[model samples]
Structures are given as structure tokens and as C-alpha cells.
Target: MKDRFVANQNAHLEMVLQQMTERLLQATSRLMARQGRPPQCNYEKKQNVWSLATSRRHCVE
Candidate 1:
């Protein structure tokens, strides 16, 4: 029963994480759209996991 409970909790956590990721991406897209520029993405490796970092470049034009 304990293993079942743990499995259920893990599933819930994964679902919540996925939802958060989707929301973040949506917000980022909207922000870029409003700014009228695409974000520059950088990938950094940390603890064997790759994560994305984004920055908006100041347009000189």
C-alpha cells in the first residue's frame, strides 16, 4: 500500500510539473511577442541535466 501511495504521488507531481512548464512557455511566448523580438536561448548543463536560459537582446536598429 505504501508503494502504491508513492506511485500515485509521483504521478501527481509529474502532472503538476508538466502543467507548470506549459504555463511558463506560454508566458514567455506572450512576453516575446509583446517585445517584438525573439529570446536568445542558452543551454547549461547542471547535475547531468540540461536547462534552458533565455535573454532578450537589446535591438540596436
Candidate 2:
């Protein structure tokens, strides 16, 4: 049935989104570890959603 098909498709998409989130978390942790300190991160609110970004700070050694 069309309803069942749509439900299955939505479930598949949800699983993919969860997997992507996990990967992003792992990558961010690695970046933080290599930087030796927490990277400067920024947050912005767009509509009902929030966005985050991280970057290394440049400092003279």
C-alpha cells in the first residue's frame, strides 16, 4: 500500500539522519582532541533551527 511505502521511506530517512549525526559527533571530538583545547565555536539561530560552527584560533607560539 502507498501508506506503508511512505512510512518505510520515512523510517529509512530517519535512520540515515541518525547515522550522520553520530559521524559528525565523532569527527568533532577528534578535532577537539588534536587542537589540545576546545575550538572556538559559534551558534546562530535560523527560524526554529540552530547551527553550530567550530574553528581553531591562531596564536603565536
Candidate 3:
């Protein structure tokens, strides 16, 4: 009986973990989409400003 209970608990934990992982992936995708692809610029001023704007837009979205 104890072993069975442990197994059940483990299964429940696994399900919770899976759900958490799915949510995390979804959040990551949304973030990436909002941020768009990485900047192509190599200069500091453009890259910094662009990245800041992307982050701000993501927050608004």
C-alpha cells in the first residue's frame, strides 16, 4: 500500500512537472515572438536601443 501511494504521488508530480514545462515553453515562445529575431546590427547604440524597445514592447504586450 505504501509503495502504491508513493507511485501515485510520483505520477502526480510528473504530471505537474509536465504542465509547468509546457507553460514555460509557451512563455518563452511568447517572449521570443515579442522580442522578434535577434538584432542584425553589431553597433552598440543601435543594438542597445533596439533591444530596450523590444523588451518594453514585450512588457506592454
Candidate 4:
């Protein structure tokens, strides 16, 4: 029973992380657009799932 509970908890955590990552990406894209720049997003994998690695914008003057 404990093993099953742990598995369920992990799955739930992964789903929540994925949703948060998606929202972050959208907001980052919008912000970059407003600033006339583009976002360079990177994804990293953790425990067989991809998560938001970094959000960066390049500024050219």
C-alpha cells in the first residue's frame, strides 16, 4: 500500500510540474513578445520527465 501511495504521489507531482512549466512558458513567451525579444527556453529531464530548465531572453543593442 505504501508503495502504491508513493507512486501516486510521484505521478501527481509530475503532472503539477508539467502544468506549471506550460504556464511559465506561455507567460515567458508573452513577456518576450512585449519586450520585442524572443525567449530561449531549455528543457531538462528529471526522472523520465522533462521540466523547465531555464528561461532567458537575449537583448541586442
TM-score of 3: 0.60
Tens-place lDDT digits, model 1, residues 1-61: 9998986896687568656766676677678879997755321222113122211111221
Instruction: Specify the poorest-scoring 10-residue window by lDDT in model 4.
Output: 52-61
Model 4, runs deviating above 4 Å: 42-61
Model 4 residue 60 distance off true place after TM-score fit, in angstroms: 42
lDDT of model number 3: 0.62
Candidate 2 accuracy as lDDT: 0.52
Q: Model 3: how large is the Cα RMSD against the reference?
A: 14.7
User: What's the distance in Å from true for residue 23, model 3?
Assistant: 0.2
Per-residue CA lDDT of candidate 3, range 1-61, in tens? Answer: 9998986896687568656755665566566668985434334454466557656855775
The collision pairs in model 3 are none
TM-score of each: 0.61, 0.59, 0.60, 0.64
Clash-forming residue pairs, model 4: none
- Which digits, one per residue and each the tens of the lDDT, describe model 4 over residues 1-61? 9998986896687679778876777787788889998666533333224422321111211
List ranges where model 3 is wrong by over 4 Å. Answer: 38-61
Q: How far does residue 61 in candidate 3 sit from its true spot (Å)?
A: 45
- Give per-residue CA lDDT, model 2, range 1-61, as digits (tens): 9998986896687568656765676677678879896634421122113112211111211
How high is the CA lDDT of each candidate model?
A: 0.54, 0.52, 0.62, 0.60
RMSD of each candidate relative to the true structure: 13.3, 13.8, 14.7, 11.9
